[model samples]
Every structure is written in C-alpha cells, then in structure tokens.
Target: MAVGVPELKIERVRQNYLANLVAAIACFLLEAGWYSAFMDTWINGIGRNRQWLENTGINPAIQYGTALVMASIMATAISCVTQLTGKQTALRGIKVGALLWAGFELTTLATEYIFEVRPISLFLVNAGYWFFGMTLMGAIVGGWKKKV
Candidate 1:
C-alpha cells in the first residue's frame, strides 16, 4: 500500500467456467465465418492473394489456437467486468461488450489503421467481427452466472 492510498478491497467474483468455454467456442466459430465471408476483401486489404496465403507456411493450428485463446481471455474479461459493474445479466453483458469494443478495440484499431494506412474496408471487416463476437461472449457470460 502506497502512502495516502487507501487499501482496496475487491470482492471475489465467481466465474462460470462452462459459460466462458461456451462463449469462447462461439466466438471462435464466429471468427471462422466472419473471415470466410470477407476472405477476398481481407486478403486484398493486406495486399495478398490465395497463392500467397497458401505459400505463407503458417500452420492452421497456430492460427486457430491463438483465436481460441484470445476469445477465452476476452470472455473472462467481460465476465469479470460485468460482475464488478453490477448484477450480471445478458443485457448488461451485451452493453459491456459493446462499450469495450468501442472504447478499447475500436480506438486501438483506428490508431493502427491510421498509421498503417490500411483500407477502411479491412477495418470494417475486422472491427465488425469483434463487435458481434464480443457481444455474443458477453451475453453468455453475463446470462450464465456461477452457482454460489
């Protein structure tokens, strides 16, 4: 404890692991669909083509594993925030997800896009996916409370 800083007491928020797992799986699936739908646009945005992508030698497992892990982290964060803010509910989770997306994800991506001079279409594709994905995760985490 630093001088003049009051001790902070944080409540233990019980998390539903099942909800987090389900939420992460849902987001992972959403990522697959979203990318598939915007495949051409996304590839073109990065100035690449199918041949280039295939030749990149990146393992699909690594890509998918990363996505799932990220989704899980996001789900847990949403759950924690939702519980901390107020009663955890599907509606509240949705709101938190949207707010977090706009506040953190959107802002950070916008900065990167501006500096990298990336296409607006690419930004929309990526950002749009997160918007929906986060909300979905939030809804699950918020609506499914861990039994105390």
Candidate 2:
C-alpha cells in the first residue's frame, strides 16, 4: 500500500506538471497574439504624442504586451498548481500572480543593470501592466474552472 501510494502521488504530480506547462504555453501564445494585434493601433495613436516615448525608441504597446503575456503565463501556471493542490482560491491566485510579476520585474531590472542600459521607467510601467495583466488572468482562471 505504501509503495502504491507513493506511485499515485508521483503520477498526480506528473499530471499537474504537464497541465501547468500546457496552460502556461497556451496563455503565453494567446496573450502574445493579442498584444501583437493591439500594438498596431496603440503605438500610432496614443503613444505617438509622448516625447520621451518617441526619443527612447520604446514602444509602450510592445512592452506592455510582453509584460501581459508573461503575467498571463505565470498566473496560469500558478492557477494550475493551486488547482491541483485543491487550494484554488482567488486570493491565492492573486498572490501567485503578484509573485510572478515581481520575479519578472527583478530579472528585467538586473538584466538592464548588467547591460548598462538606462532604466526606461520600466518599474512604473511594468508594475501597472503586470498588476492588471495578472489580475485579469487570475480572475479568469480562478473564477472559472473551465479547461484552457
């Protein structure tokens, strides 16, 4: 019985891992596609008027889009973990999403420092982007149990 129990646990873990992988990949792809489409109108419209944005060669849409895609992937992965563990809740989803966003932000900041690139005011922009992005993903995944 002990051996069987261990095997069962391993199988469950494997299944959840696969599920999280699939969810993350799917979420990333979908969000990326959405961002690509959104960038066209966004860049030429609202972003064109900002002098700093123009001089910096930074595309707000692209940056925000990438952040959104990453946030979605992370939120989906967390949702999968929580679901598998039978502790799925909106608060847990939010916490996971926030952690994911923070992780990405730290990595980006570190990379920028290493490359000797000027900080592009990414902290504010990314914070807002990830907050909304992850919140939306969490709400969707935690609020809805439908398979992705």
Candidate 3:
C-alpha cells in the first residue's frame, strides 16, 4: 500500500505537468497566430519598416515576443493550479488566471520602465488580451476532467 501510494502521487504530478505543458503550447500558438496575422502587419505598416529592427530603440518584436512568452507561462500556471486543486470551478479558474495575468503585466511594465520606455499604454493593451485569452483557457482547463 505504501509503495503504491508513492507511485500514484508521482503519477499524478507527472500528469498535471503534462497537462500544463499542453495548455501552454496551445495558448502560445493561438496567440502567436493572432499576433502574426494582425498586430505584426499593423505595426510594420504604421510604426517602422522591417529594416528598422537593427536600431537600438524598443523593437516591437521584442515586446510581442515577451508578451507571447508571458502568456504561455500564465496558461501553464493556470493549468497546473486547476489540476492540483481538483476543483473544476470557473470562479477558481478565473481567479488563478487573473492573478497570473496581473503578474505578467506588472513584470513587463517594470522591464519597459527600467529601459526608459513608455509602457502604460502598451500594458493596458496587453492586459486586455491577457484577460480574454486567460479567461478562455481557464474555463476550458477548469472544465476538463480525467476519468479513473
């Protein structure tokens, strides 16, 4: 019984880790597609040309890339939390998702600020994206159940 219990615990942890990873990948790809299709084109047309990437100022590529990475991390964290809590509750999921979003938002803002760049407006825009994306991801993950 003791040996079986340890094995079962390890298995559960591994399962949760895998689920989180899958969730991260799915969220990352989805966000990346949206960004590439719309935001990238718009930025390139309005803000700078492709060759401007070689300049030293805040490159839009770095900003978008950072946001994508942050979204993946948030998705993974939400998935792991939902799995560990074992409560497929929407409220719980949203709470976890929101917290993760806030963390990333604040971190990104701080990084931009430290670099002497204007970040409040960008943070606001990214916050909206995070809110919707994470809410959707949380709802789906929280509603998923594993059968014994």
Candidate 4:
C-alpha cells in the first residue's frame, strides 16, 4: 500500500510448551549432576566448603526453583531463535544453543570470573554445565516441533 515500501508479513511461531518443559527439566537435572560431580572443586573454587554451604541458610527450594526458571527461559529463547532463523531441527537447535552460550552466558561468566578473580576450574565447572545443558535443551525443543 506504500509508495516504495513492501508490506511486512508476520508469521506466527507455534511453540511447543511440552518440549520446552521437558528441556527445562532436563537442564535442571543436568545442573544437579554437573554440580555434584564437581562439588569439591566448586566449593574450593569459591573458597568455601560443605560446612559453609550448609550454614549459608539459603533454602534449597529457592535455589532449585531459580535454576528451573532460568533453564525454562533459556530453553524458550533457544527455541524461538531456532524457529525464527531457519528450518527447525535438532542440529540447528544444538548450534543455536552453543552459539547462545558462547555469545551470552560464557562471555558474561568470563567477565565475572576475571573481575572477581575466580578460578578457571570453577569457570569451567559452571560454564561447562551450561554449554552441555543448553545444547541438550536446544536439541529437544528444536526437534520436537508443534504439529501444524
């Protein structure tokens, strides 16, 4: 309708909530296992131990809930980007996941680690978990498309 401007066609993206939920849960569980595996190194890297952690008075529910919520958000974002960019597939999702981690999560953590003088081991422990977790979630959500 405009003189030299083309009409913008907005396409609707159908989100698979089930896939997202599954991805989030998977991410959360991966976190648990990752941390458990690196518990000693993590505690040491933070300059604390089991005793300090137990005495921190942080509620387990809050911590777990936060992780779940964050994972859900990340999974949804990956799915959205995967769908918007091109044909949605497990490989695309995985690539998107890794790229997002490198672009956002890894960079952010690297800055914090540098400024806070945190150990590389700790960074690896935390960042590695996210890399794997996000990729796994991406694969799930990307592959599980909503029926048209």
Each candidate's TM vs. the true structure? 0.92, 0.46, 0.54, 0.93
Quote model 3's TM-score: 0.54
For residues 103-140, write the lDDT of model 3, one tens digit per residue: 76557655875576544544444556566677666765
Screening candidate 2 with a backbone cut-off below 3 angstroms (N, C-alpha, C), the clashing residue pairs are none
lDDT tens string, model 2, 25-54? 545555556546555444543335346555
Off by over 4 Å in 1: 1-9
Check candidate 4 and list the clashing pairs: none
- Ranked by lDDT from best down, the candidates are 1, 4, 3, 2
Total clashing pairs for each candidate: 0, 0, 0, 0
Better of 1 and 4 by lDDT: 1
TM-score of 4: 0.93
lDDT of 1 at 73: 93
The better candidate by TM-score, 2 or 4, is: 4
Off by over 4 Å in 3: 1-22, 33-47, 50-74, 84-86
What TM-score would you give candidate 2 relative to the actual structure? 0.46
Let me know the TM-score candidate 1 reaches against the reference structure. 0.92
Poorest 10 consecutive residues of model 4 by lDDT?
Answer: 6-15
What's model 2's lDDT at 148? 41
Each prediction's RMSD over C-alphas, in Å, is 2.9, 8.2, 7.4, 1.6
Off by over 4 Å in 2: 1-75
Query: What is the per-residue lDDT of model 4 for residues 106-127, given as tens digits with 9 covering 90 to 100?
Result: 9999999999999999999999
